[model samples]
Target: MDKKHIKALRKIVGEDNVYDDKAHMIAYSYDATRTRYEPDAVVFPRHEEDVSAILRYCNDNHIVITPRGAGSGFTGGALPANGGIVLGFEKHMNKILEIDMDNMVAVVQPGVINMDLQKAAEAVGLFYPPDPAGQDYTPLGGNVAENAGGMRASKYGITKDYVMALRAVLPNGDLIRAGKKTIKDVAGYNIAGILVASEGTLAVITEMTLKLISKPKL
Candidate 1:
């Protein structure tokens, strides 16, 4: 990226969040695959609006954007293979917004770790069932991107089955919401279904409302 482009990015996310030096670039270059495809810059978005602005600028400049979570995926989904911007979410956007026991749903940012939610739910006598092996380290967003499933999946189901709603930014920077929090509120096209396992191809997921079930007695 040119100096002008870098300056613009820094303005959107602040200098501290935009990295282009060799060290930072190298660190974000590879995931579990260990295959390196260095990005020109790595940008961390602190909120959903930051993501919208960044994607808007990148779209206007024709710069590629690769959305990433914890970088624990076995597949190279988080790699900036085309080399532009690696939009990292783990830095600041890793928040669990709300856990509504009334609805048995949890609202979280894309950077929330899988096990974190599982523990949080279990503490409340509820269960977030999709448990990928990397649940200890993997982000829930990455799990949804991959449609990941683990041992409990045989009886409980996978990530897609638990996702109730999503707020995402499209390639052109449009912020959109798909699905609803209530299971009975299904009245639109399955946009959330399409985004599941899309692996950041369709849009960049920012926040999600995930369904939870009552904890089973062992």
Candidate 2:
């Protein structure tokens, strides 16, 4: 990216939120794969609007963007293969927006930690069943991106099974919402299913509504 582009990005997310220093780039260069390729810049967006602005600018400039979560995936999904911008969500967007006990659901930001959601649900006598091996540290967004499965998958299911809806910013910066909160709705194409496991190629997930179930008796 040119200096002008970087300036524009800095304006969108603030100077402190955007980093181009070698150390910062190196830190975000790799995922659990351990293979590294430094991105030109790394951006920390605090909200969906911040992400939208960044994506819009990147799109107009034809800059490649890799949306990243907790960097815990065995696959190199979070790695910046093409070397443009690394959109890191861990620091600012990691909030569990709502734990809807009545609906048995959770509305959360993409950066939310997987185990944190599990524990929160368990506190209410509920469970979010998808538990990847790295759930302790992995972000829920990464799990959704990878359609992660765990030991209980045979009995329960993977991330896709629990995801009810998603809010994502497309490569062109257009924001879209897919799926619905209701348990059963064959209203249209299953766009959310297509996005799950896309590995951040198609869009950047900003928020999600996840299904929950009663905690099984031990």
Candidate 3:
């Protein structure tokens, strides 16, 4: 991107929020992969709108965009194959909006930590299944990106199954919604399923509507 673009982004997210330092870029270069390469820049968007705008800018400039979440991926999913923009969700958008006990669901941002959610749900006698080994460090968005499976998967299924809906910032910078909360609604194509495993290839998930299960009352 040009100075003009960077300047605009800095205005939107502030200069402190944007990092072009070599050291910072290097740290976000690789994930759980053997391959490694520094990103041209790293942008931290605090809100869904900011994420959409940044994605739009990158797509317009033909700059590759890598969506990063805790950098805990195992298959090099977060590794930047090409030098481009690396978007990290660790800093902002980490709130868990609500745990809907009546419907058995949780509304959370992509950056929410797994254990935190588990703790939150347990407090309400509910549970968010799909307990991956990376539960300590992995974020929900990254888990969804990999369809992350764990020991409990045999009993509870994987990330994809619990993902009822998501708000995504697509490659073209257009904001889109995939899936829905409704139990049985054969709407448009299963675009959400396609986006989940794209691993940053198709779109970046900003928010998620996950299905929760309350503890069986005895």
- Please, what is the TM-score per model? 0.98, 0.97, 0.94
lDDT string, candidate 2, 41-146, tens digits: 9999989999999999899899999988878787899898899999988889999999999999999998899999999999999999998998998899999999
The whole-model C-alpha lDDT of candidate 1 against the native structure comes to 0.93
lDDT of each model, Cα atoms only?
A: 0.93, 0.92, 0.83
Give the Cα RMSD of candidate 3. 1.7
TM-score of 2: 0.97
Q: Candidate 3 lDDT, tens digit per residue, 1-218?
A: 46676677787787887888879988998877656878878888999999888877777778888888877777888887787778888888888988888888899998898888888998999988788888988888888888887888888888888888888988877899888886685878988888877787888899888888876564
- Model 1 residue runs over 4 Å out of place are none
The number of clashing residue pairs in model 3 is 0
Candidate 1: 10-residue stretch with minimal lDDT: 67-76
Question: Of the candidates shown, which would achieve the greatest lDDT relative to the real structure?
Answer: 1
Reference-based lDDT, residue 166, model 3: 86
Q: For residues 11-85, write the lDDT of model 1, one tens digit per residue.
A: 999999999999989998999889999999999998999999999999999999998877777789989999999
Better of 1 and 3 by TM-score: 1
Worst 10 residues of 3 by lDDT: 1-10
User: CA shift at 147, candidate 2, in angstroms?
Assistant: 0.6
Better model by lDDT: candidate 1 vs candidate 2: 1
